[model samples]
Target: MTAKDLESLLTIYKEVVEKIDLGIHVIDSNERTVIYNKKMREIEDMDIDDVLDKNVMDVFHFGPAEESTLLQVLNSGETIPNVKQTYSNNKGQEITTINHTFPIRENGVVIGAVEIAKDITKLEKMIQENVYKKGDTRYTFDQILGNSAALNEAIETSKRATRTTSSVLIVGEIGTGKELFAHSIHNGSSRADNAFLSQNCAALPDTLMETLLFGTAEQAGTEGRPGLFEQANGGTLLLDEIDSLSPALQTKLLKVIQEKKVQREGGTEDLFVDVRILATISEDPIDAIAAGKLRKDLYYRLSVVSIFIPPLRERKEDIDLLTSSFIEKYNHLFGMKVAFIDEEVKSYFQEYNWPGNIRELEHVIEGAMNLMGHEDTISFDHLPIQFRHKSSSSGGSNDLEKIEGLLYQPDKAILPLDDYIHEAETYYITKALQHHDFNVTKTAKALGMSRQNLQYRIRKYNIGKNTHS
Candidate 1:
């Protein structure tokens, strides 16, 4: 290409890099910072002058045993993809990012490196506050609001787990109160006075998970942070969705449980921790193993005291008790005296399959209550459209009459076209959800829209509330 053409291309490349949502940092082979994009400045909370033309080590501090991703790639001339790194800027503010770092080479010789970073500082902090923050667990045996035989059996077994420090694995489907059981076990244990922290394994990438679980060591004037294992010392640490952990992490977890010691992510020193580990899985351990999502040896190690909680479908009898509890809870919160669920609504609840389980049922009740107004009961109409129109035989006449009323009433004020379109879209989506038996994936496919787009519309329109009459 000619010089003018090359200049134009370079200008376009710079513009695109600056406009990109991800943070971009480029450093020479000597680790001198060269290109720091606008997004990178925002992520690191730095200005262009703060980082440009400076050595990376001078701009950002890494732990003694750790190295900058850009430097690592520059030295090795290798690409490192999807790596989560935690470091501090010159201002001593901590930043966490998932980075894809690549070497810039010429004729098989490394010249420089570029790092693409997605800032996850806020996300990491949120997860840490959730799982590593020191606090007393909220749930105990008395608070686990179910009396079904299946649930009670699981509770009894979990209570047994409190008597020993052996690892306990609570297995149940989503919304089956597996975390509740974990908390109850911890509260009932001898170490109740200590911390009870929990982490959802599925909530983070493997790199972040590793660092958060094991922690980082202090080095080179930077402070170190404790991982979950250390934070829960002399207490209980619950790893929810344990099966979501990668094979490598599972093996490391097994070693920690067996050795009763944990080494931080970048630290050479191993710290002994007297933490009782509790874990939960949303599926059968055997099934997870067969599917290659879980490690067999790790399962054996964690399931020393296994407690299985039955799904809401299996324990349908508890629906009344759960329904009453939720109603009372919402009643107190909403300051509305909803006296009962109409028999038809109760019957429909029993007949419809709750793919989302207890959580789904609870949300349904919540949504219905939002539309209750001064009504004394939750009726067929109060139920979300998905549930109200599940059976084709029901609501056909009423739905037709409601649409007719909207279209034919000359005395009614004309609504904005946008409002009419909004209502129509809501009605159509509800019909699609009903046709698909409330399966979001199937409905989204049938509607030729993404599931996320459909979900956004549902929330935006409050589609379930009154179903527009």
Candidate 2:
């Protein structure tokens, strides 16, 4: 190559090195600094005049006989692997940096040593914070609260899954606490000390998701962004609702999981990342794959540790526990003094088919607390009309016998449809009024009616004035 062309190439290379976020320094064979980058200057908080042509050891305050990785590399003419260290800047602020030193050669002869230092002060802080905050008590296996065989098996499976690095796939209906299981598994895993980053695949578009998961290169925009994989490195990544990922994005994600590397959009380099994958779906992944909504290969990869959270209705034994938990949560949040769910109200909750699962239960509890005001006990009066129907339909044999014995006898024929309807409405309205402390507004809303309408019905049915309001 011509000397002019070589000089131009060298200028471009130097400019590129100077602009990197990592500190770069070229030291002569004598172990003196020959060239240094802007990041090196900023890391030391120094002006060009203060650092130029200085011996590498002279710039920093190092103890005698305490050799640096750079010094060792220069002396042995060998490469030194990345070494993490703390150095004080000119402002006396200590920062963490990873340094790698290698011998620089010219004409096959070692002429100097080149060192690259990357500032990782923030990363170090995050690591320390994660280590110290290892035991977050937001959730536990006991929080699952179920005695059903299905639930017990699922919990056992989750416990087993936590011991491995295999990817997990959780499937359940909406509001079934799929995310809850994900959190429990992450907290139970060996990587509990690392960050647990979760993102719903259904929440973001393909383009945005790609950028969020794999980041963007410097050439893509002015500010380079780190992807979720990079941020969750050495941690767990929960991809909630993985079934919602488009086919194209599925291919990209498969590549990342398989290779454990990500090439940012518009960047040529592949970055290695270590992250445990946990994915969730509300639908049957096998059916979804058949329908072409999800990729088969991706499903197989994620199903290495599969778990299915049962809907609330299937685990009736846990209903009371979940109800009490929600009531406590809302009681503290809304400043309500509610202390218990009366048998009548608990019966209603247990009977209701919780299609929306635990999340729906939470909403129902919050709604009941709001309607019950500061009452110490939640009663059937606070339940909605649909819930009342469920209660009457599913209440124990004793409750059925009581209702039948009070209204009719075995010798009598079935009551007329209108009479039965009237009795049911009367029973629910009376119970609702009592639950709401006789507040017509709340009772009406719970029954999906207006105050005037409820009042008219109340007068027509000749219901008693047991309510105070």
- TM-score of every model? 0.65, 0.56
Candidate 2, number of clashes: 2
* Candidates' RMSD to native: 13.3, 14.1
Local distance difference test scores for all models? 0.82, 0.77
TM-score of 2: 0.56
Name model 1 segments beyond 4 Å from true.
1-33, 37-123, 389-469
Q: Residue by residue across 1-469, what tens digits does model 2's lDDT show? A: 9999999999999899889977987888877878888998876677776666887667765445345667777788888755655765445676666677798888978889888986656554534453212244256676787678999999999999989989999999999888778888988888888877877788666765776688767631134567789888888888988988899999999999999999987689999999999999888898999889899999989899999888888888888878888888887898788888887567567656777788878877777777786579987677555555554445433343545423468676677888867776777777668756788886776566898899999999998766444
lDDT score for residue 103 of model 2: 89
Q: After superposition, how far is residue 45 of candidate 1 from its true place, in Å?
A: 10
| Candidate 2 stretches greater than 4 Å from native | 1-137, 384-469
